[model samples]
Target: LFSQVPLVEIDGIELTQTRAILSYLAAKYNLHGKDLKETFRIDMYADGTLDLMLMVALAVFKTPEEKEKSLALMVKKDKTQNFPIFEKILKEHGEDFLVGNKFSWADIQLLEAILMVEELDASVLSDFPLLKEFKTRINNIPTIKKFLHPGSHRKPPPDSHHVEYRF
Candidate 1:
């Protein structure tokens, strides 16, 4: 019933909202969580990661001068704020994944968010050693590794042409 750019259709059903689509896929793939509490934790982490992702998304639409400023601000906030929380979680949880010591949507979201920031600043995770390790660990997963291989479906960072197209 919904119509939008991110619409996803499967099994004769269509999901238009980003969250709805992600939730559906997460649930179907068994990445949501094992219980309510775990689901809440996964949602919390995924939402936080989305905040970072949004910043990167907005940066791409800015002029060169503004883009640099936006990216710098994004990196500053990520280093001083967002990255620390995730680093702490990895430290205290003593787990490879962010929630329940199992691979979940949260891990996938965080890895994607981290990579987006790294596109602007290669050393974005330098201060967060745990996050670096986490990225490496997640990147090595066979499925993810295959998806990340060159010529995969991954979209490159947005360029000036994207900004023009959006306007």
Candidate 2:
């Protein structure tokens, strides 16, 4: 509803995914990194986080047998393996935000990652203090803080319309 509503207009330039939308906005508004190469690196990390969250969401509502299988695989590859890779990038780029010191599309991607897993299991973040801190930091930002709370336009859609991955 948000994208096609009274105040929201859908542009003809079609981007297929959330990450693409973020990237397009960032580049258009100069919220991307210092240059093209840095922008690509930032996007790569953001996309990786998106992929990980998608896997976790799949595991959350699967049937018992399927859930168990998905959980085992994700715990190994998604959390244990893939998470640390992002962690290292965040640490290496340890300026308050990902991809240079300015807030960029990467921050939005990371916020989505945290939100995706937070409802499933808070403990999923226990191993990554930086990730936890990153979420808190982003949410506290004046602009982002508005959306983090209820009643904001960016609040998640009602449950009925949201994607539920029951198996």
Candidate 3:
């Protein structure tokens, strides 16, 4: 059984890998853009989202001191280096969603990554008003609210390597 997470079954077809499955569903459901190039752009943003998540994951696997050091390096990199790209994207889009001005998989992917960072340090996003607004708009949507409500379902128990800390 393909019980691994990110598994999706549609019309007797099984899908694996979060990004591949999401892109497929977006195309099938008409959630993606009208043009091929737009889809590529969305994929680019999604890739950036995955990169941020990977940075978060990197810290999770290290010893406590290493985790602290890693996170410190991550924060320094985030605060001084990369957030401007996201902030600029938000301003350029000038809408609730990232590309094509509608809710799409890129928005979902980035939002998920942002929330992960928030769990580490909510203040990080406060420095970027547009990003903060982007998060708020996504979070306040009726569908998103219902899907992510606190009581909806239990998250899996923390694994042995899980480390909880705050900045």
* Highest lDDT model number: 1
TM-scores for all candidates: the values are: 0.91, 0.71, 0.78
Deviation of model 1 at 89, angstroms: 0.4
Better of 1 and 3 by TM-score: 1
lDDT of 1 by residue, 57-166 (tens): 77777778998888888888888999999999999979999999899999999999898888778988988999999999999999999998999988887788876875
- Candidate 2 lDDT, 1-167, residue by residue in tens: 23421132247544545555666677876778898887887788778777766676555455668866765665556458766776787799687887777788778877877676565556777898787788888889887887767877764422323335221
Give one digit per residue, the lDDT tens place, for model 3 in 1-167.
45555578896898988777877887886767668887788888888777766676666567768877876776666666656777888788687778888777788777777777666677888779998888889889787778778887524323343444321
Q: Which stretches of candidate 2 lie over 4 Å from their true place?
A: 1-19, 56-78, 154-167
Alpha-carbon lDDT, every model: 0.88, 0.69, 0.74
Q: If ranked by TM-score, best first, what sequence of candidates would result?
A: 1, 3, 2
